[model samples]
Target: MSPRLLLLCLLLMLPVAALASVALGAASLPFGEVWRDVVSHVTGGGRPAQITGIDDAIIWGSRVPRTLLAMVAGAGLAVAGAVLQTVVRNPLADPYVLGVTSGASLAAVAVLTLGPAGLLGPLHLGVPAAAFVGACATLALVVVLSRHQGTTAPVRLVLAGVALSYLLQGATSYLQLRARPDQLSGVLFWLLGSVAGAQWSDLGLPATLVVGCTAWLLLHGRSLNALAMGEETAAFLGVRVHALRLQLLAVSALLTAAVISVAGGISFVGLVVPHSVRLLIGSDHRALLPTTALAGALFLLLADLAARTVAAPMELPLGILTAVAGAPFFLWLLRRDRSAAGREV
Candidate 1:
């Protein structure tokens, strides 16, 4: 399909997905009633009639926030992936390549095991806050280390991230090893990730960070496209390579950080969504940004929907579903690449 048509189709799917998100969950909600409730709530009519207490709670509390989190997290990740790929000029670069997820995981685990904030409280304090701090600190370290006497070092930056990831992973593993059984369960679940515990109160912070960063990214799409060719080439085209580089990297990191704060660690939305959009809409970042946002949001909402409904009352960990769904698809891409390369060879 043409990009125009594809955009419209994806846009249409957004509302449909949003509606489906409301309609289906662990509760046996009648679609009609769910829709009526949602429409009433959204249109200012008030809560729809409910047959039971649980249904009222499920429709109002759980599903709305979970679906919104999925949408925002998915969009944030997809944008982060696109930015990382452009900034690093590596097709394989995704938001998590920097080991942001590792840092977040470590922080979360620490919160779970031993902290001033006990169990439930620290889960809020120690996890998300520590994750964002880790992301910022790692990037600062990478930026400082990636520079030599005076020059920007792309390979150095990437290598530094890889090394840092392993180091952080080691720290995270040690925490897990020493935790009490209850703490271990907390740590394990955080590592797995889910939107099961979402609340409307949870949306504002991550949404602001992502939406702001996305707007910034969209504004710089042209520069990003030029930069994709190479820093020197982008410079030749009158792009301020360093300024733009720092800006895009900051935006990507922030986006990754925000989503990781809520969802824990969702891998490959960044990788998968961008690649999928690029195939359909081509590589113009302007088109790709919005397209990726819509597609990514829709993709994740559907994934979350499946995560909720597929297993029914027992919720599936979203991380497991995304990885299970994404990893194979990614491998297929790799296999295709090998086949093409083999033919060429």
Candidate 2:
């Protein structure tokens, strides 16, 4: 199918995916009631003000926030992956390829376990604030390490990211080992990732960042296309290679930081979603980026639904589900690439 047709199909399926995510959970609601409840909530009418119940609370309070966060976070991460892959000219590139996820995870773990409690000092959003700071610090370090003669080298950038990721992961592991039993479980769960505690208020920052960054990226499609071809080609095409790389790296970091802050360290959305989309619709950047966002949103919405319902009342971690699904697909991708290279040789 063409990109346009595929896009339309995805657009049509999105509402169905969203409704399924909202309606199916530990305690499944009837589809009709789910529809009615949603309509009432949306229109602010059908249900009487005096009548309130657990169902309404579950639908509006828990499910809505969780669903929204999953969708937005997935979209943001997928777009970040697409941008990084093009920016670095690496098929393996994902949102975490620059150590952003590791950095964010380390900071979040520290705040959750180490108990400086007031690290952010009075703001009380310590975990997220610290995570964002860690992500930015990692990005800055990676950029600096990869720079030579005032330009970033893609190979150096990837290597620096790999080194930093390992370092940060080790630190986070050490912190987890030292954590109190009560804290250990939470830290482990956070590292594995979940959207169970999502709130309506938690949606703002990530949604804004994802939408804004996606729009900005959509505008830079041509530049990204040139960059994908090579730095020299991008420069010849009048793309400010260094500046564009900087801008993309910053945007991707911000995207990853925002999503990880809200959703913990959910994996594979960044790694798998973009590749799946690109397979369905060729890698044009313009089409690839937007469709990747939609596909990411749809994929995670369904994944979260499965996460909640797969074991019923006992929720599975979002990261675990994604990894379980993503790993095999990624392996297949590698094999396919290897086979193609072999054929060429």
Candidate 3:
């Protein structure tokens, strides 16, 4: 199928997925009622007379924000994954794989455990801010470690990321052990990833970053294509390879941090969505980026719906579902790459 057609199809599926996400939770409201409530609220017509305060609260307060957060976080993470694959020149690169998510999680967990009077309180850094700082620091460290006489090797990048990820995750585990009993559940839930506690206020920064950074990325699609070819090739093509790498890394880290700050540690949306989209629509960044974003939004919307509804009252963590789906795909990719290498040799 053509990229444009696939894009349109994804665009159409978004509302359907979103409506399902909002309507099919534990209570299972009727689709018509959900639609009416949505339209009423969006049109500024106040709550529908037929809709009770409880129903209105469920539709507008909890599910709506949660769905929107899932969409925003999914789009941001997918785009970040696509960018990282190009940046590291590896198919295996993603926020979770590269330790970016762990870095962010460690920072956010520290804040959650430490509370108002803790170390970061003096700096006045919230969870999101601390997570962003941690992501940037981790990405910088990985890049530095991956450098071999000034250029990054794909294997070295992956190795460095794996090492740092393990170390940071170990730190995160230690912090969890130190958390207060009441705080531990919240911390565990956050680490596992969920949009269950989403609110209107949580939507703003992630939405803005996803939109703005995506636009910025779209403008540089040709540069991304060049970089994907290789640093030597990209420089030969008149792309400023080093400067572009730094910019891409910074943007990707920003995107991951923004999403992780709010959505916790949802994994594999990045790895799964972009790669799937690339397989379907080819790798023209202009098309690939937008389509990946839409697909990511749709993928997470459905995943969130299943996370809440599949087990009914006992909601599953968003990360568990994603990891379950992504891990097997990761192994397949490794095997496929190895087979291809063998064929070439």
Candidate 4:
């Protein structure tokens, strides 16, 4: 199948997946009603008289925002993952490779375990704010550590990220251990990820960043293609490999940090979506990026739907469903790659 055909299929599937996400939650709204309500809301029409206030609230107040956030976050993470894989020349790389998730998770977990006041004194930073700060700080640290002779080496970036991730994750574990029984659930939920409390206000920054960064990245697709070939080859092509690596790392990190702060640590969308799209579309960054974004949005919308409805009434975290699906795919990917390597040998 052509990449264009696959892209078209994904585009058509997205609205359907989004509709299912909004309509099939615990209360289970009818799709027709949900579609009508959504159309009315989007077109600035008054609410349908037949729709009750509670239904209006459910549609506009909860599911719509949640679904939109999932789409934005999913797209952001997927693009970030694709960029990271190219920057590092690592098939297994994902958005979390730079320790951004670890940093964000650690900060968010701290806020959950200890009250905001406990850590920040009178400043009282919320989990999202603190998480963003932590992610930026971690990115700065990694950049500094990875720099040698005034250039960032991909190997050093990976090593620094791994080291910092382990150290930060240890601290996060300690905080979780110290958390009260009542606090533990929130901590775990944040770590595992959820979009349960999404609001209209939450969508603006991430959606903006995702859109702007993705567009910027699309324009640089040629440079990314060169970088993926190898740093030496990219530099040989006059791509300014060092500057490009730094820019890609920064962009991908900031994008991942933005998504993680809003959506908590939703994993595997980054790892799974980009690779799946690559397998379908081939690795042209131009096509791969947008297709991955759409597939990711659809993927998370469905996963979130399952998270809320699979057990009904008891909502599972988004990460749980993603992990269940992604872990197996990851294992299969490893096995397949190993087999291919053996064949080459």
RMSD of each: 3.1, 2.3, 2.7, 2.0
Q: Estimate each model's TM-score.
A: 0.91, 0.93, 0.91, 0.94
Q: Could you give candidate 2's per-residue lDDT for residues 260-283 as a string of tens digits?
A: 988899988888888777666667
Give the per-residue Cα lDDT of candidate 4 at 58: 94
Candidate 4 per-residue C-alpha lDDT over 157-247 given as tens digits, one digit per residue, 9 for 90 to 100: 8889989999999999999999999999999999999999999998888899999999999999998998887788888898988788888
Is candidate 2 or 3 superior in lDDT?
3
State the displacement of the C-alpha of residue 200, model 1, in Å, after optimal TM-score superposition: 0.7
When 3 and 4 are scored with TM-score, the better candidate is 4
lDDT by residue for model 1 (33-58), tens: 77776677789866655535577578
lDDT of each: 0.79, 0.86, 0.87, 0.86
Error of 2 at 48 (Å): 4.3
What tens digits encode model 3's per-residue C-alpha lDDT throughout 189-266? 989899998999999999999999999999999999988877889899999887888788889989999898888999
Clashing pairs in 3: none
- Mark the regions of model 3 whose C-alpha exceeds 4 Å error after superposition: 144-156, 327-345
- Candidate 1: global Cα-lDDT? 0.79
